[model samples]
Target: MDSYRNSDARPPIMQGSPPAMVPPRLDWDRPPWNRWAFQHIREILPTAEVWRGTGHRHRLE
Candidate 1:
């Protein structure tokens, strides 16, 4: 069971390399905050459902 124990205690690594990039620190009034908010608007906002807006139909004749 040594292998199993080691696997559980090992730190997570990305292919033994450092993280691809570190996200910038967040400040409540900084652009990073606004940028993050805009990108995640769907999660924070109570959006209406998007109904079927396309008219494409199957033509299997």
Candidate 2:
């Protein structure tokens, strides 16, 4: 895995001016653009808060 961590590694997609190589688009369903879009879904899609409550913790089976 260390071989994949080089100087040429893809930089994190950030807000503001778009990075080179990665195409920019409003539709996140496409490739490359979807990579950043999916990672930042809260920024693009409508979201709501779900209350889990401070009750007993459920164990996963």
What overall lDDT, based on C-alpha atoms, would model 2 receive against the true structure? 0.69
lDDT of the candidates, in the order given: 0.57, 0.69
Summed backbone clashes in each candidate are: 0, 0
Over 30-49, each residue of candidate 1 has an lDDT whose tens digit, in order, gives 56566655666565556777
TM-score of each: 0.29, 0.41
**lDDT value, candidate 1, whole model:** 0.57
Tens-digit lDDT track of model 2 for 7-34: 5767766845554433454667578678
> Candidate 1: where are CA atoms >4 Å away?
1-8, 12-30, 49-61
Ten-residue region with minimum lDDT total, candidate 1? 20-29
Top candidate, metric lDDT: 2
